[model samples]
Target: MPIHSFLNYLALEKKYSQHTITAYLKDLNSFQEFCNNEFDKQRIIEANYAQIRSWIVALVNANISNRTINRKISSLKSFYKFLQKTKEIDSNPLAKHKALKVPKQVQVPFSEKEIRNAINLLDEEVDFESLRNRLIIELFYTTGMRRSELINLKLTNLDFANETVKVLGKRNKERYIPLLKPVQNSLKKYIEVRNEMNTNETYLFLTKKGKKIYNTLVYRVINNYFSSVSSKVKKSPHILRHSFATHLLNEGADLNSVKELLGHSSLASTQVYTHSSMGKLKEIYNQAHPRSKKN
Candidate 1:
């Protein structure tokens, strides 16, 4: 099937991450099923905009969020574009379609004080798990790495001599992030305890059984710790990432530099942090400007 071929293209030619490829495949399969059931169409390439619109209407009636529906639409659009590119189809059906308007969601970063307090709450005992968790938090806050990047981190990636850690980001792009003195200290301590396990795991972070850490465990670690420190509705790895970018921008870091640190492919993705920084700017202006505050 062309869908299978397209998925192969995404996996091999595009070099998309497995997680991304899975999502695309899921979206494509969902659309294909809809076309088969609703319009009795056997082939997705034979679908037109009206059939696509009917499926979208059904999605809306099913109460799926517009943001999610838009993502599904994007998946279909990519598929159709691919079909056109391969000459399987004469034209793209979604060429004139506009993305659904998603409401702006401003994610609040944990304050520096909140982060400090959270770190302070870590157990004073320096066990492997404690050290590993501490180092994980520190790495997220200091380096702004995605959870996947952190998960795939290897012992060889940490360059103590150069004070940097190389990260394998999305699409297998590699970037080096500088380590702060505190992060370096934590890493050293964690390694000291980790070595006592005597296992030859190449991955930096490991489970109690000396296995590589997975996504759920990482999310739980972040959520469990941050739940005690901040009252934010969401407590996840990405929040620490948001805190990293927001805090850096608040401290006067340039946008391009922050973009590079976060491993964002484009400046536009990094621009979202500026909204959080704008709040800080307003606060500074109100406090420092003459006659800014009411008597």
Candidate 2:
């Protein structure tokens, strides 16, 4: 089917991650199902804009958020674009479509003190899981990598001599992030315990059963540890990454450098973290500016 072809294009030509490709496939299949049920249309490739609009309206009535609905539409848009590229379709159905409005959300990052408290708590533990979990937190906070990048990290990705770790980021982009002393120490200890398992897994982080770590398991590791030290509503890997970027920016790191370090494709994507650094900027401005001296 054209759906399978489009998926192959995303995988082989576009070089999208498997996780992302799966999301796209799910969105496409959902649209196809909607077409079958509502319009008696078996083929989504033959669907018109009106049917697609009805799908959006249905999603809205079902209480799906605007952001999520937009994402589903975006998947269909890409599918039509792919069909156009391959000459299977002469016109794009979603070319004139405008995305639904989504509210801007500013994610609150963990305070530096909370991060340090969590780390200090883990520092007292001597077990394999504890050591691995500590390294997971440190890696997330220090390297600012996505959960997938950390889970996919292989043994050869580490370069202790150069103090850098090779990360395979989105769209199969590879970038090297320097490792801090604390993370290095944690890695050494974790690997020492990891060696006792005698598993042939090449991935850096693994389960007690010698298998690669899954997404929810990684989230649990972050959530369970931070629950003690943070009262924030969200405690996940992305928050740690946000905290990493915010803390660096707060300490006077350049925006462009942080962008490169975080593997952002554009400055616009990196600018979201700048909102959290405004307080630090205000403090610095008040201290350094030649304005008021008790005027």
Candidate 3:
């Protein structure tokens, strides 16, 4: 299929992450299957709205999630657009279809106490890997960087004299977060241990063999940490970041400040933590009001 060439274009020209490319492929392949099973068509290039709409009906009948189905539809739109650009087909068939919609749930953020407990669980007596994982957790919460930004951080990014670490955020933008004393000390210790292993001059964090840390390893460390800390809350590295912004908001930090700290592209993205703060206010209001008591 010419879809393969378009996918290669996405990887090379578009510079999308492998994860995104894989997702696009999965959606395209699913559509290909739908065509074969429903319309008896083998080529994605030959598909039209009649076949694609049938795929949507199949998705609904199969009870797939609104989010998943929406993403698949969006993928089809992109695929058709790619085909159109290459003259593989004339018009984008999936463009006019309305995507499935889902409401965005407001996720609960962890409390400051939970953050403290999780960090303390990192035993200093353990080996370098243990300490490195602890420091990764610490820096992530402290800096509120996205996982990709954190993983891609280089040794040269740290500026000790100025007490700030410059992070290259999404779209090649850079931002600086302050280097707190505790974080500075933890970073120093990690760097000391990191240097003792096989030396790599570029990447900041690494395995014992001096390989760069990958997303799976980072996610595993975060998952294990979350499991040990509190089962009451949903946990991901992003949850820690949400906790960071919420804690700051609760402590009187302004929305714009939190927005910049979080590297959110828009104020709306950062405004969700304001909702968290409002929930706290509602709890206090309900507790104090005499008529608010329930039997």
Give me the displacement of residue 260 in model 3, in angstroms. Answer: 2.2
Give per-residue CA lDDT, model 3, range 1-295, as digits (tens). Answer: 5878889989886668899999999999988888788776668788778877878888999999888899998887888898889888889987678877798878787777777877888855457888888888898888888888889989999999999999998889899999889999989988888878867558888887788898878888888877877775567878878878887887678889999988888999888878878866677789889889966
lDDT at 102 for candidate 2?
A: 91
Model 3, position 20: C-alpha lDDT score: 94
lDDT of candidate 2 over 1-295, digit per residue (tens): 9999999999997668899999999999999989889887669999999988999999999999999999999999999999999999999999999999998988999999999998998888999889989999999999999999999999899999999999999999999999999789999999999999979999999998889998999999999989999999999999999999999999999999999999999999999999999999999988888884456
Candidates 2 and 3: which is better by TM-score? Answer: 3
Error of 3 at 241 (Å): 1.3
| Sliding window of 10 residues with minimal summed lDDT for model 1 | 117-126
How high is the lDDT of residue 50 in model 3?
85
Q: Itemize residue pairs with steric clashes in candidate 2.
A: none
Measured by TM-score, how close is model 1 to the native structure?
Answer: 0.69
Candidate 3, which ten residues in sequence have the lowest lDDT sum? 118-127
Ranking by lDDT: 2, 1, 3
TM-score (all chains, Cα) for each model: 0.69, 0.71, 0.74
lDDT of 3 at 131: 82
Give candidate 3 regions above 4 Å deviation. 1-47, 61-63, 71-92, 95-98, 232-234, 283-295
Q: State the local distance difference test value for candidate 2.
A: 0.94
Q: Which pairs clash inside model 3? A: none
Q: Candidate 1 on 126-223: residue-level lDDT in tens?
A: 87888999889999999999999999999999999999999999999999999999899999999988888968899999998999999999999899
Candidate number with the higher TM-score (1 or 2): 2
